[model samples]
Target: MSNTMRILGAPNLYLQGPGAIERIADIVANLGKCALLVADPTVERMLTPQLTKLLTSVGVAFASAPLVGEVTPANVARLAGDHRADVVIAAGGGKGIDAGKAVSRAMSARLVTLPTAASNDGPTSRIFIFYDDDHKLLSAERVPRNPDAVIVDTQILAGAPRHLLVSGIGDALVKRYEAAQCVGAGRPNMFGGRATLAAVSLANVCEQVLREHAVDALAVAGSGKPDESFEKVIEACILLAGLGFEGSGLSIAHAMTRGLSALPATAEALHGRQVAYALLVQFVLENRSAAFMADQFAFYAAVGLPTSLAELGLPKPSADDLRTISSLTHKAPHTRNFERPLSEDELTEAMLQLEQMRQHSAG
Candidate 1:
């Protein structure tokens, strides 16, 4: 008989927000006992005390792994083996959440991802970034478990740097187009699987919210207000971006971002920042109407996301580098959904076109 059954369940839930950290006790005590909390030093200092206090209040056994660097294999091995946690609580930004996902999977424990910053969709994802010893990415690792719970309290998310919130909006806005590309290219997602109908619908919702409330939401995030508009944007950043990308599967936009991130110049840009630029490149490569993409630029500009190369803090790639990287991008696991196969020359041209758009827009 063909084994035909798939209904995975999250062992714990994620909780987000300012005072949301204080609720850790209520959420975790009900889930399990011994817990391992993973975060970076800075994030730890910012969010850990509250987490610790909450855990202490609930009488849950716990430990901490303040991840100091990228989630290299060594990092994962060290963390997963060292903590040996029964349940995992990942706090802070995307990196911390991805690292915690790795730790939870490796150690055969339940995971909960808490994001202090709405920087990307990694918080609600089951995939984690993998890296080589030198901190270069290997690829994404697909884990068996999705976090049992995802907790987002608008209060905590709004307090993050406005730039992080802008990046989140950038990351979210590109999903609709990326989903189309993925479908066109026949590319599999992080799971090496196809996109589901549920995923596609989620992506559309994300795009609609982005087009509608991104600026208002971002303003609220920056302004210390949790009004209806602010709450809407936070919801879009978390639930919409989170559920959309994971469910819909990425296409050229994200694939392009992954490829761009491999470049040294773009390596330092935030995930959402990189994703925003990738969307620009896609508009060029796919022959998408500038008028259509112009709205995207407007939305990003309104939110303070860098709409140009100068804003992204990078120089133009040399023709040689662009050509070489473009050739390599074809091999990306997510590129198959693109409408046309990209060549080195085409990729190089796309970069040049983006440069021109940036220059034209700036002037």
Candidate 2:
């Protein structure tokens, strides 16, 4: 399979800080003349005037396509077909950015992503996830390349809901764990090549940033101020984690979370939140030491991540529920990415063990 090759992928340009959004007009102009902006309703309402002024000053004609619903293939297809523009800018939260990625791909337009919330790695990855009309995850579509640019205005991120940042930390926390597994096994990354030294290093850095700064960043993020810790955490969560996961690889942690979709009861849980708890299950599957598990458990609890299914709104998962989730994990393509075989029984046992630990930690 030519697994010896090394590969890395990333957005063309990444801009951050308080005034980054103000530069979007020039950035968009450099890429294309006329742009179509697909933004969440909230972004359209809150930032349109400033965005409009910037674009006008730069003489970049732009049109707005407000995102009215969840990111689904049908919705993205519709947007791509309906909007004829030189470039597509997905502005706002994860859904809007994902829609922008898909729509840009469908239309063959240059892509730009402006994320208002530091909630996940989707903002910069070459992958965009879509859900079915029923809100079930449909697929993770890989674009030909990453976004042309990813603009993260920490001013906006600072004002975002604190949970979003915490969830981002949850998502970023797994990068080193998963990447280390992939590297140790000589497994191929998302692009079907071995992880490069650079990719592995980025994953390690992402984990280090989260370990050191996430909690303090969460504290200042609530006040809506762009502090140093907030900037570092945002970079780790969005940029570094994006590069790390996509360029290194996803392992059991993500596979387990993806499996949670099989349960209708977990439909309301956030993606990052699900991954946070699933990491504990991975620890069990890997037979990590109790000291290591306890350290991770404490980190999750301090960051407000879901440490138990109860927090995920499924406090009492029946045996059937556990079996279903475990089976789903076994069926996931990512589960196979692990060096060792992953079984449904192991998943079930790990989940139960996670719950027991949660109880013990509580006591």
Compute the lDDT of residue 148 as modeled in candidate 2. 93
Query: Model 1, residue 314: displacement in angstroms?
Result: 2.0
Task: Give residue 125's error in model 2 in angstroms.
Answer: 0.8
lDDT of 2 by residue, 202-236 (tens): 99999999889988899888577888988999999
Off by over 4 Å in 1: 1-18, 132-135, 185-194, 222-224
TM-score of each: 0.90, 0.97
Best by lDDT: 2
lDDT of 2: 0.85
The Cα error of candidate 1 at residue 343, in Å, is: 1.6
